[model samples]
Target chain A: MDGIIEKAISLRFEIAAVILFGIGFINLLLQSNLIKKIVAFNVMDSSVFLFLASQGYIEGRMAPIVTNGVTDAANYVNPIPAGLVLTGIVVSVSVSAFFLALVQRLYKHYHTVDFDEIMMLAKERVE
Target chain B: MKKDMWKRFSAWVNGTSEERGPLELPDTAVHHEKKKLFELSDEQKIRLFKAGYLAVAAVVCLAVVSVLLYTVFQLPLFGDPNNPAVNDVVERYVEKGLEETGAVNMVAGMIIDYRSFDNFVESSVLFLAVTSVMMLLLRDKNNISREEDIQEEHERIIEKEASDLILQKVVSMVLPCIMLFGVYVVLNGHISPGGGFSGGAVMGAGLILYASAFGTDKVRELFNMKTFKTVTSTALLCYAASKAYSFYTGANGLHTGIPLGTPGAIFSSGLILVLDICVGMVVACTMYGFYVLFARGEI
Candidate 1:
């Protein structure tokens, strides 16, 4: 119990990320609107970014920017995760844009934003 | 005989005129009542199924959250230096990145130098995404010629009405500065936090602002589909070649004595600055391409 408490306290940001992930996941599943699902996907992306960034945190280190004369490993937090997150952000942007484009096409075809209605319409067409 | 029977069966299933007309119910009231009963039952069944699925989804979500929370306890504590994340590789990057890559910004160095192959692939993905979006959204000009003329007229009216004196004057004043800043960010990526992705985005935003304020025609005068294709393809090709050269030399253990010029200088990182420029071009073109394709369905 004590260890669990310590872990929770120390990993507060990670817990926050997990909470955020849960909220986004719930929204994605429960929301019927396609736009809301996209928003939930973004929320999930941010949470994952947060989790990765939090892993690189050090007790009292500066950003990975090398100051005038500082070169010590202890002076800087991990830069790998930060770089990965940067690339991930770009990927997320591209993905969201593509998804939005797809949604636009869907809207044009079905004349509705409701996923369930679209599915039913598609079923009717097939029948 | 089998084929004939199959054809007849399909026609019946598809509600052929002959079958439906001949089988018309004499007691229409009774037929209507039975149809209503089936519809009501079907609706009720669908609602029940949806509710059951929601319940199952909720349970699965709860289980996932619980499992994630439990696993969190097993991971290393936040800000612990002894964690595996801050291991030897990270230490080497922090220490040797400056001397090796000649980039003051370690993140830029790592991205452009250490993991450049990944960045190259990422830029390609962006290019491919824009291509895919274009393929999906772009309409044929000949087919929509009449619609295009109407749209153009409408756009001209909107531009005239919306782009007020103050808006035009302010955007024109700031547009050059925005473009310059983007270039500055890309060039000095090695010395600062800004790099290709951000710099390119800024430039793309500037272009978008120009298009919105002065109209796409004016923006197209400067940057159109032709320019986009040439710039993105050429930049990506150049980046791939440069990275391939470096990778080949390194893998073969041939000491290519290319100097890592003085850190903090604009031309310090031999290929990083060049790569940054290439990436910036690709990203900016993609951003603009997406906007144009989405807005007018062509570029």
Candidate 2:
């Protein structure tokens, strides 16, 4: 039963990751809307994070602390992944903020948020 | 499915997690169309300009002092433990009688005894910031209708498309609980992870919630410029004077006259209570000032 559950969990993870990446890829290729593409990008990113975070929480491990309230080895999951993820999260927030600000500027310049309209405006400006 | 999986699989490659985006969102329509604002008056322009200036100043300051801030913070959290100059101070005054201070509030003890001056400076900061925000909000603008009924005033702001009912409901429901929890955290600081800093923050959260949910007019009803300034200042001055009194009078220790009732008990510590109260008020007022600045987008 335990082995079956493990297999199911692994399968679920792989399936989710593949679906997320597929959505992002398909949307980028097919969708004309730039905002929709960004949403899809976020979906893919979340799936990758989900995979990393789940793998880090290994079974039967304690949180890092000194054994017997003194220095001795105690079993614990490595905290490096958590630290990496924290930095990644901050970067992601910064990227999103910059992206949105850029979006605002684009909207202001073209007076429209449609992709084809923006292209037309750029062409006009160049001409 | 088995056939698909098994047919000569290649070595798994872990690739870039933050994908290189082929799709740019420059022309992407927002999921919702934001309603257009008709005009920005002269006042709004000034507010926007002032906000921009503050943002620029903050960025420049961070660049300049980032290293100094990092080192100052690091010495306490991750310093050379065995170095004599650093180690001896920790060994004698700090380590000795730490338990006898009967203060389970380690952060409080550290603030009040080790670095009381910094704490005082921080409190003065709260007083000054609050005064500035109040002045900003209540500046020489004419005819902001002084409605006696708060609920009526909130209702009137609705025509200005003040936001949906969800925010008001959320703030009213959550603010009281946050304030209650803040007091609880501050009171139990001695034995727990949280202290006056976090507690006062929670209280500030409550005030901000109320103001955001209702409006600044309702806020004025709740607290006046004069009362808020006077109270916070007096409390802070009292905190400074306590230390000065002890120092100049040649008191043996803070523990001299005060009964150290019982170890680990809340009131057992000599000056921890006073320190906690001061911290709580400072944190609360500082947060309130910040919220006013944020809500009004000035000062």
Question: lDDT of all the models against the reference?
Answer: 0.88, 0.53
Cα lDDT tens digits, model 1, B1-299, are 34435656777788884644424536786467567877788799989989998998899889988999888777899999998889999999999999888888999999999999989989988988898888777877533547556886897788877776777899999999999999999888989989999999999999988888788888888898899999999999999999999999999998757778888888887899999999999999999899988887878
Backbone clashes for every candidate come to: 0, 1
DockQ of 2: 0.03
Query: What lDDT, from 0 to 1, does candidate 1 have?
Result: 0.88
Reference-based TM-score, model 1: 0.89
Model number with the top DockQ: 1
Q: Candidate 2 lDDT, tens digit per residue, A1-127?
A: 9855555454454445555655555554444466765666666666566544444443455432212322111233333334334334433433443444345446646767666568757976996
**Inter-residue clash pairs, candidate 2:** A35-B28
Please report the candidate that would top lDDT against the real structure. 1
Candidate 1 local Cα displacement, residue B71, angstroms: 1.6
Give the share of true interchain contacts found in each model: 0.74, 0.00
DockQ of each: 0.73, 0.03
Off by over 4 Å in 2: A1-127, B1-86, B132-138, B141-156, B159-163, B250-256, B297-299
